[model samples]
Target: MENGNGLKIMEKNGLSLNLKLQNGTKVDNGTHWCFRGNKELDTPPEITIRGVLGMLKDSLDPSDPRPTIPLGHGDPSYFPCFRTAEVAEKSIADALHSANFNCYAPTAGLPSARRAVAEHLSADLPYKLIADDVFITVGCTQAIEVALCALARPGANILLPRPGFPIYEARAVYSHLEIRFFDLLPEKGWDVDLNAIEALADENTVAMVIINPGNPCGNVFTYEHLEKVAETARKLGILVISDEVYDHITFGSKPFVPMGVFASIVPVLTLGSISKRWIVPGWRIGWLATNDPNGILKKTRVVDCIKGYLNISVDPTTFNQGALPHILEKTKEDFFQNIINTLEHTSEICYQKLKEIDCITCPHKAEGSMFVMVKLNLGLLEDIKDDMDFCFKLAKEESVIVLPGIVVGLKNWLRISFAIDPCSLEDALGRIKVFCQRHSKQK
Candidate 1:
């Protein structure tokens, strides 16, 4: 049946999942039946980088022209201390000057880029990887997209970490893949619950996704914890998709351990990018490396499926691809050391100050990523209703913007970024303290 807008009508088991202009009107028995009219596409929740920025802009006070503090967004460009590495800049400049890179590269990405990424990532591995096992992506997000597309098979489900990157869940949902979520035990320093994973898996399970140095949790996993996760995945015959975009940016007592270290034991698909390390979110260059030493992925033809999907997909810019080798090679050790040192100092400041606030509690100081996840003790405040309410009111009242935990799938919690300049971070913390005290029940 055709609707007024020319959208084809479709029905699923019993639920009516809206497609074009109209939303699912009804779901009978677990099945979706699309409306029979051509309707306009509905606006999805503000999930994209640009959409959130727009929301933040709309929430700003018109009387004030000064830029709003953007702790809500992940990009570090707002901080002068996080400026791109000089060698990264020079490498990209050189690539722009190289006339050979002006042409449209392969859809799967340039061979040299893949080779450079393979070499750069292979440093932490016990086994060497060939360039053929590497695939260059526009960013780690696309790598997750491609992986989900390739792994989609009927009746097969993928396990994802709850409060995980929604892109993984979004991509899987769009591809008609079933999603099974396992818990990250926050009490145990954000380690995966191996028992939960085992219970979630069956013969139909294909892969499990884990974000090392977790995104919202802000806790890095110990080697023993990672080993158990690998063992559990191996026992279930599922591949591991390791999201390591924040791989080395840690200030915690525990070290960041890459899941690729266990490749010999079980197949692993490691996704990483220089965006976080170099503070170049706009660069949009990332890599997906297959760490299957036993060739499990190759034997299953997963590698070919990934390449086939990439052939028809968009790729990273040619110039950025051309700059990979020099960016990897010429970036000085001092630059990385300095960035880590700064992150360490800022994390300490954020952590210590958060403790003094009566209404907010941080589970752990962010050990790795650019952000920290803190629980909002709603019981302690009279004005705050919930996480979103808290953030909305805080933005209006303080002109400070912080991500609500609901955005990351954790309700009543907030994710705050401490990646800004030290003074600004302290200032923001001061604003937060004032907000908490103002809303405190005693007042």
Candidate 2:
């Protein structure tokens, strides 16, 4: 027998049962339950750099003897050459031993930790910052999320750089903020195309993000250029979110300039962390500071939004927060200098090695951050299809890992991390050269 709608039915003692075969067709068993039904959870293509790299890693040969050289991301703590300072490690150990900070931290952060971050960041700016202006986050990643959430409103838009960090795009999309892209002119040392930025902004544009000592490009902005960006934001009546997570890691002639220096001209949200500088990304301690000496952010209630969000969000690890004061106050300058020196040496080696490869061209030598964006000469390689194909082939054949530029919104280019040990970096580049030579069309 069959019930309504041709469902097979059975009845006993006035109870009816409807059964359907578990075929590949959609079956409503009093609920629409299917593993593939929810499209909302599906990840969009090219949305995350990690996801793309993970796919390439899965395709790597199991029989390969050489250890995988990760030139993909900016993590180098695994290498002995990039270890964190002893003082930072000692501070965390001391905090743990004291047993004073195991409890939950305050919503914004621990008062002492916030104050320490304020003081540390204030040292670089003309104006001073109080603890109230600093909010501790899990890492710069959360700092970015909180900032975007605070700024996003219905029918509002934001400006981002092209060939930029994918996190900004991912967060903006998740927050329902309309994103408009402006170009970073590669021919001009990857400077922000100010004219495009001006054209992209409308009255509905809420904010613009600038990643100084840029993430994928490794180009640092000069003070004059930052001044123009500030001016542009002020004229647009929009806020500036300065991602300075890689602060002061410069190797080239241009010194690292914090976008907060121009906060007097426009309201700026400065995001920073000890991750890159201290070489301890796993610590999960970072801050978002409002650099508005004029109280513009407070006046607009953007500060209130951030606090409200933080009130419901998880704070960074308490013991790590307890260690911040010591980390900021006692870490020797020589420790920082050593990191810069090592990065400078590794970057030069990578650049010189890359220059010798006939199929790749580096537009500019890496100046600040741990990455360099190089244009891949796909035409010179007969078998490789695109950046994705190139990366897969390189990983499978050479046991090397590098980020495809398509993940960063630039096709036919590559973002290489030179932050590994100098010897490993040299070896990886050499392997890349060999791979390119092996696939060269000339042969």
Predicted structure with the largest TM-score when compared to the true one = 2
- Choose the strongest candidate by lDDT: 2
Residue pairs with colliding backbones in model 2 are none
lDDT of 2 by residue, 1-443 (tens): 86556566567679665455344334453553354533433576555888988877887888999889999998889899899999999999999999999999998999999999999998988888999999999999999999999998999999999889998988888888999999999999999999998999999999999998899999999999999999999999998999999999998999988998999999999999999999999898999999998999998999999999899898899999999999999999999999999999999998899989999999899899899999998889988999989999999999999999989989999999999998888889999999999999975
Stretches of candidate 2 exceeding 4 Å from the true structure:
1-30, 33-41, 44-46
Q: Which regions of candidate 1 deviate over 4 angstroms? A: 1-43, 46-53, 65-67
The residue-by-residue lDDT of candidate 1 on 224-280, one tens digit each, is 988988888888899999999998888778888999999988899999988899989
Q: Model 1 Cα displacement at 409 (Å)?
A: 1.3
